[model samples]
Target: MFKGLKPIQYAGREVWPLIEGGKGVSATNHASSGAWAAAGGIGTVSAVNADSYDEDGNVIPQVYEGRTRTDRHQELIDYAIEGAVAQVERAHEIAGGKGAININVLWEMGGAEAVLQGVLERTKGKVAGVTCGAGMPYRLSEIAKQYGVYYLPIVSSGRAFRALWKRAYHKVPELLGAVVYEDPWLAGGHNGLSNAEDPTKPEDPFPRVKQLREMMRKEGISDDIPIVMAGGVWFLRDWNDWIDNDDLGKIAFQYGTRPLLTKESPIPDIWKDELTKIEEGDVLLHKFSPTGFYSSAVKNPFLRSLQGRSERQIPFSTEKAGEHTHQLDVGVKGKNFWVAAGDLLRAREWDGQGFTTALKTPDNTLVFVTPEERAMIRKDQADCMGCLSHCAFSSWKDHDNYSTGRLADPRSFCIQKSLQNIAHGADPHENLMFAGHAAYNFKTDPFYSNGFVPSVKELVDRILTGD
Candidate 1:
């Protein structure tokens, strides 16, 4: 029997199957989350460097005044805690006891555990659940249990869930709220694409999530436990068979891209305008993140620049051997290095075109760049703030003498700088715009045909009619 989408118990309150996925750098803020909660759905507050407001509700820029990289890292932690606390407080007031609020964090972010503990301790009884992803978050359950809040671990495959359940999540099953299976190929933001998986080949999430449910059921978890499907979900009618199917068990849908156009969305007006104009394939999935993970972003000029940089790369050998016939003309010539004969002409052309500096990557390849670009890359690397547990860009590990013992990678960029700039009204084309593949639908969706931006309540109502 089809009863349509209805409310269900989540973290102590009955709420709709709808959930607003958390976006970092103040994209999902208090006003937007509060409005979602008021609409009888779970709202997520992004605890990843959330922004704090001034007395007049203006966003206060996060300026670092520290003299050292480690000092700046501490400043970042303080900012994360204070901003998350403020957002949670506002969300609680706006909810007015109607719906629940969940805090979202990335396990790979620098000082993730410390930020979670700090925010949870300060905002007692305010947050209902914690959603975490972007690495094996084994300690997430334990931390949530300590604070008496539900925990949702986001994974891309069944093997990941089985591993987490066998290791730590099984020990704290009471507060386990839901399992979020984010599609690696189609999802926005940081993807969980494993080594065995091909990024170019996308898989259907139906079978993947069903297998996850089977694994959970085998682990003694009830069928009532909802599996929230995130990434590439736009219309509920498109997923009719998944709603009440006995095989998939209880289900929910989460939207990270749809809410960006809503009235309460905190992003700049330029971002909203740009979203409407985005075409299919404008968003790209690439490996440019310093966290050594695959992430999806708009293929704007900023992303294109990175792609061009990688294209200019070529493999080289320290000494000439079999098939290593051409001498590297752009680099130290007397070093006995060799490159492919075909690449020698290209390298010479690039060098003649003022791209005189060559930087070596961890993969034993050399990337040629202009002197000015080379200087900028070095400066950005020197200003590393330890934003990730381990960064491939600056080679700054949070611990172990604060170095990964590897050369800084030029293929990746500092995510913190770009996200912050974009969130605070910078150019979207110049920043990394994370979005699901279905984001292109905004152009044709009748609801947004006439430049109409719905309120959170309006969006929820529209979603309820199965439109």
Candidate 2:
């Protein structure tokens, strides 16, 4: 049972210590988030390219009609604002003025500030707070204050929180509702892994969260403010000690993966069905995102293809030096292309296998792909609508001529395309499926035996029982 756990005051209201973690690309939508809110928990709506519906309740396809990158970017922002507004309105109606609903956005997403402002302007009292991460969102507090809503910053470690608090969060201390400590290595989708931390070794979150509490106390922040512990959270029984621990005051749990199978979830039936079949170790943390941040997803055929591409890569030089005396079999700039003798043989072998096209990454590395793959990559890059603030894949920057002045990296793929396709009922195995590490629990959990899918209220009720 959820003993000694009480409702925490958040967004000027009392709500359960359960938060529905925001999943992007319409994974969490009006139906899912609204039900979560009505269930007395905080419902988080994903503002990253949210979806809007037509008069008949059909999804409005996000088709870009602009011929240029700049033109398409404006279209993207307009679509984002429209979609967020619709989602918030529906969620508010379903909530019946109970619980709280928060909108989440990534700081690195293109037109983030504009989209947030526009959505909030239209949403008005519907939204309770804003949860932002994926970068140091120093402006989140100030912006949320302008809209008269609370602001929550998602961070990994205490040092990161300290830096943000000192920089800008200090001035708006009253508006800072809560701080989320997302385990970078364990969380799904884009994470906040820093250079000091090793991804292969995940440190225990207990000590890290305790350090954050100490930092908060020293800063004169109230112990009443909740610390949302996200990542790898499946069962409350596993975290019994954390519920009422003095070291970490007012703790809450955020679930990013478990909610995908609920009846109200907006994802396609195929996606929900696949969640019940996941096994331990099926989730993989990799660095294939165009945002240049580490992300976790199911190890599907789509990810396996990227892994194979990177594995076949080899370093090359412009001029012959040392063991690089062999002539390159592929012509790019000229015969000036130089590689080690062994690499030349490998390149030839790859070419014979029809992986003939060579593409250069910004890191001065070459990855070989088939002609079809090369054409697809070029087409995706050309169709960029500035979806990210600074994309490493397409080099589409949201500022100044809309270019990052670097060659598009072939190692990264366009996230917008893959996520949108999956959410729209594409083959789950061929798309990037963001999932938490504990997603495998769905397969073994008795609550989901025989492919039983519960309503949002039933799920929340079950969670309160410490199942």
Candidate 3:
């Protein structure tokens, strides 16, 4: 038997504690999130490069015309603020004063504080809270206090929450809306897996959430402040024990993957169809993001190509030392390249296989690729608009000399380019498709059988029944 969920008081109103996960790059927009709020559940508008409309009510494509990376980064921030304000305004209109509306942003994104301040300034009463993650946001509470909105920080462990609470959040206790626990091994997109956590070993979320709750109690936080469980959540029936359990305290579910299949979802049709075809273990947790963070995505050719590139890598030394005795001649033009005997043969083999060009990485290694592949990688790097605060692929940093001071890594790709392409109408097989580990449930879940896609209302009602 499933324990039923009760409506909770939030943002000065009574509404269901359910929240729609805010997806980025135009995935979750006014349509889906607005409908979710209208269904009496909290809806989240993605403030990460949301879509803006032209006068004719058509989606305006974000095109950067700036000649330099820094200039183009400013353009990106402007687009983000404009698009987010529009999305919030439309969502509030669609909601008709039902459930509250929230906006989500990544603390590591370029010009994040500016974007948040700009959006909040324009849409004063529309947004109820700001959901931020991907990095430790000590200033989130301060920003929330400035705008009179609640702030929810997404964390993977109790230790992370403690750090935030001690540094800044304790001062603004009234506006700390909730703490989101995103499973690092299971959640989609940019994960919060720390260096101490093993990516291969997935830990259970129950004990972790319980630890977070206990820590919160010690900090004098009220039990009503929910620990919103995000990632890998499919059905409420499976989480019966978690609901109404005093150990966890005021739990709410946040669906990041399942809602992508709904009728109101703003993803492309091809992306929606691909969701149904996912099989078990199709999602991979990898560390290829340009932001130097681990992210989860579909293990398609796009991601496999990155893995293959990394596999073709071999360590090189400027001066001969230890096992680096063989002077490599293939792929690289410089005589300074020295490698091990076995790696030299492997490099030759890779060169013979059409990976004729070698690119240097920041880790003192070289990755072999075709000349055509090398050109594309270079072009993508040159075309970078500084989406993240720091990028490993282009070596572009938002502050301090505008460079990471390291060689741009060929092993990583331009995330802004790939996500924008996929969010538009690009082929799913060739783009980075982010999805949670539980995404495979779309295939086996009887609710999705017969290609029956539900509306936001239907999905919310069905979820309320513990399905």
Candidate 4:
């Protein structure tokens, strides 16, 4: 159907019209990417925390004892590199004789160089390209050139693209394969929010993609440099104007969420079913992450917990003399609970809602909840053998000097622990499932066959042909 489209040369290999966006954890694994590449398109295997598994599919021992975030982050990177190498080898074997395989990297994640180096060394020339996001990857071109691989940076705006071009594109122009313009609001995972951009404002991605093409041209990058459009892209018919058009320049569509419903996608069935049944407005962009960035996901029971917590919170200040000394006594004798008026009222509300139980700590801090909830929290904490450097769930830390410093925050849960659980078919309601806003279309889309999952080739054909 897209016969007029010419094959673009990237990393010295030709690829088809499709480009699969890299998903984190085991979501976007080698099997899925290899299937996409086997269809003559580009497949990106997510390498974030890539070295998470050992040769026997078991999690390797993490060296970080929660002492230092920096030290823990480094250890995580080493493990990620090892894991990525294993994934690449598996993907190459599956690619068989189709298109090429690419590795996806998060710039903000630690051990970017080490992970890439390990994968490249193991795969040798089998690795075709590297796609990076999460931050401005200014050194991508330089790194890609060293290994004779193509580099594509994911950006949300033309200005961001130009900044990278002026700094690095001038030197390794050939290494630049394409510019991926991911819709910050529509795509899943972490979004690229500008300082001035409002989260409520829904910006049209078509104009932005065109704007990026013009900016690339101004920077000496030609029309030949493809612009891969991601996020909210479901059907080619919705973007017919972009294809075979001179004004928009050469373009390709990147799918991040839709691919999850395909047979080759590694997401658990529970996750796919949730995406299939999601309502139009169910996905929300939230700011609860410690990374201080907005993340997109379904507004399920998991998200409701965070929302409820946010709504009940009230600001407390010890500024005024009269406001500083007032305290109310509640909970057990040894564990006394002292809280502001607002906190008491919220606790009462929770108590009335069957979450009855209150405890006062030796430090005079008050926490309210049910005995069952407390037991579950304790179980979750006990199960945590130190996933993150200093988890808020178990209060585990790598260092000893700091209280909350060395201890995990009781308020926050371990993301890795919960996400891994959900990814492996655990109860979806108990864990967070991140997805793009376009996930709702799966319900009505005829191509999905009422959530009857198709293979990667079938899904890609539907996207290209608009069936």
Over 4 Å off in model 2, which ranges?
A: 331-333
Candidate 3 residues lying further than 4 Å off, grouped into runs, are none
How high is each candidate's TM-score?
0.97, 0.98, 0.99, 0.83
Residue range 329-413, candidate 4, lDDT tens digits: 3323332234566676666677677656553222234455567756765666555543333344555543463224433333445
Clashes of each: 0, 0, 0, 14
Candidate 4 CA-lDDT value:
0.73
Better of 1 and 3 by lDDT: 3
lDDT per prediction?
0.90, 0.91, 0.94, 0.73
- Predicted candidate 1 versus true structure: per-residue lDDT over 1-467, tens digit per residue: 12467688997779998889998879999989988999999999999999988899877788888888889899989999999999999998998898789999999999899999999999999999999999999999999999999999999999999999999999999999999999999889999999999999999999999999999999999988899999998888888999889889999999899999999999999999999988999889999999989999888998998998898888888888766788897844366668989888888888898778888898878898888888888988888888898999999888769889998898888899989989889999888888888899999899998899999989888887776
**Number of backbone clashes in candidate 3:** 0
The candidate 4 region of ten consecutive residues with least summed lDDT is 328-337
- Model 3, position 288, has a per-residue lDDT of 93
As for lDDT, the candidate ahead, 2 or 3, is 3
Model 4 alpha-carbon drift over 4 Å, by segment:
2-6, 51-75, 319-325, 328-344, 351-413
Error of 2 at 295 (Å): 0.6
The TM-score ranking, best first, is 3, 2, 1, 4
Error of 1 at 452 (Å): 1.0
Quote the positional error of residue 358 for candidate 3 in Å.
Answer: 0.6
Q: What is the C-alpha RMSD of each candidate to the true structure, in Å?
A: 1.7, 1.1, 1.0, 4.6
